[model samples]
Target: MPLLRARPALLYAAVSLACPEGALADEREEVRTVLFGSLDAGRSTFVSAGAKVAPGGIGRDGFVTLATLGYGLRPERDWWGDPRGKAGLTPPRTLRHTVQAGAVAGWQWVRDWGVAALFAGPEIAFEVLDSPGTRKLPTPRIGARVQGELWARPTETTLLTTTLIAGTARWSAWGRVSWGIRVPEWSAAYLGPEAALYADRTGYRKWSLGLHATDFAIARLSFRVSAGWVYEEQIRRPGAYGTLTAWLPL
Candidate 1:
């Protein structure tokens, strides 16, 4: 299967929308903010911050809507030499940076047995490549993204989720099966297996074990962590990868 390549912050936001009954919800309407970061084994890193606002009267009978805005940065290194060669003076690595800003309107509906949500919006980004020998100016690009999520609860303690995110530039899809576990003083804990596919030049696939926690604090907050290996068909060696995200409601 292919792995989805969505930004971790956006993925967390989609998960929050899918599981509205979890720690992301409050009795009253308010704005929720989130800060997230992820580092991959390939030396790629991303950081993002976003906020969602839910107005009163938008949610009724298991249906809700929210307005969201976010900004993200991706910084990665590109080396000029082959790693398989003997140790010698290696060429300097280039630093490539991508900055993005976007907004989306999301709608979610929940029933006794399942939940569904979708969000779509436009984004603009700038990319800058700083090579060892040359400096490049920021190049601008415009794109749009559409993301959908579904959650099904077969039993009181088991939940299944599938998410797909597609955009003008890239696409990714993932699925997870979680079993709710008992944790002292915590509102919820889920242990699960997750798999993902990304439509990229290298066709990356990810398999990992994941844990999701909600309401662990007195205030509204959630945490997710995943560790696993990533394989690319074109690459000879697979890489180990891990991601941790903390979301706080303010």
Candidate 2:
């Protein structure tokens, strides 16, 4: 059980360390909006929506802007009781509800590189072990990202780009890289691999690898699909899943 619990914490920690420094970039002000949803093999579902509008890049030559907002909902429950069969063991674990809201902003030096700062408020709602009422516990989040483009090749209007990011969130640092395959059929793909360290005070680590696909159907609309795997080092519990994200550009 200790091994199973340690994995997620480590992955979350690594995610915190993979973003770039946005306060000091070179670019004009820009705004980006994103929304994502996911479900696991265990039937757990999660949803999130966020928007960011930056007014100016950090410095005079910065090419990116800074702005932020975020919200999320997720519920988790343990249907199977503890398998340990140890003394003083409790009954089944009830469902846990989580609501989160936050703000973040970042600047970019180019299309593929920049930095950002994230602030979040996460609330954990749960009922007393034996009681029926609910209680909400709020937690704070602070994140920093240092990201840059590692490779890019452009021929006329055709281009292929890859970017690397290291971000710090709470007490963990995460590393991720995104690959964009352009030209050919106007399609893009992203694969992100992340490792989390020192997550939730557990000495364990988690590894998560994800893939995303984007198809450009029109000038203003796109279709996206994604899949990923989450593995815990200590336990045999590994999560595998896929998802879809639709984007309409304004």
Candidate 3:
């Protein structure tokens, strides 16, 4: 799943959005994420960790635009792409492998009730489509990506978050929106429903609906989780999917 990979910042958004102005909900000001799920073709996993820092120091007003520098590992295997031609003139469902590494930097406009941000970066993807019996195909090696986010709290105990990402690599894109209510007894956690959509140049598209949770902290680490069902346009059926995200201070 090629996303804005904004989860790097999205994790930060989780903390910043819910915090009081000029204050941080958690003292840990870093992003360490592990997003993993099941794909019918195979399995999917993405892990990234980076810290947020304001140059020099933060202002008394608390308005800040933080930069992120870190590492990301995105591996796609047994993943299928659509045919390259029309009229049945191209190969179909070509399985491929892709490797990507990139950096993301964004500015955050933080408020007591919400946060808005935009991020952009370059991604290099090394791809090869090699199936046991199919012809080897050539693919591009690099791409650029951009993403935007809006996280808001409509009520003292509710959350509404949305993020969108697109990239030139594999012509992939992703978007999701989730709504949750705060649970004071559970470390002020938020729980609710979420919907996500994604697509690729291979003409693969999917829609997913599931449950999401936020702010489950244990000691120095915090956690986020999403689980649900996905309907694939390519396969014309439904499959199970789950994702877990963790964050630690740099």
lDDT of 2 at 171: 37
CA error at residue 141 for candidate 3, angstroms: 2.4
Give the TM-score comparing model 3 with the true structure, all chains together.
0.69
lDDT winner between 1 and 2, please give it. 1
Q: Could you arrange the candidates by lDDT from highest to lowest?
A: 3, 1, 2
Stretches > 4 Å off in candidate 2:
1-43, 56-94, 111-175, 186-206, 215-219, 232-236
lDDT of 2 at 158: 24
Give the per-residue Cα lDDT of candidate 1 at 14: 44
Identify the superior model by lDDT, candidate 2 or candidate 3: 3
lDDT (Cα, 0-100) at 38 in candidate 1: 32
What is candidate 2's lDDT per residue for 1-250, written digit by digit as tens? 3222211111111112111111121121222322222232222333444333323422222332212232322222232334433444443434434333333333333323222233232222222222133344434544554433322223222223333333344233333444433333333322333222212222334455676543433444344445677664433367764544443321
Clashes of each: 8, 33, 0
For model 3, residues 108-196, the per-residue Cα lDDT tens digits are 66555556767777766665655544466566457787877788767666778898877786588888899988766766678899998
lDDT of model 1 at position 92: 44
- After superposition on all C-alphas, the RMSD of every candidate to the true structure, in Å, is 7.8, 11.3, 7.7
Model 2: how far residue 17 lies from native, Å: 18
- Provide the global lDDT of candidate 2 against the true structure: 0.32
Candidate with maximal lDDT: 3
Per residue, candidate 1 scores C-alpha lDDT tens digits across 72-169 of 23222234323422345444444546565656667756455555667778766665656553455746767776767765555555556676766553
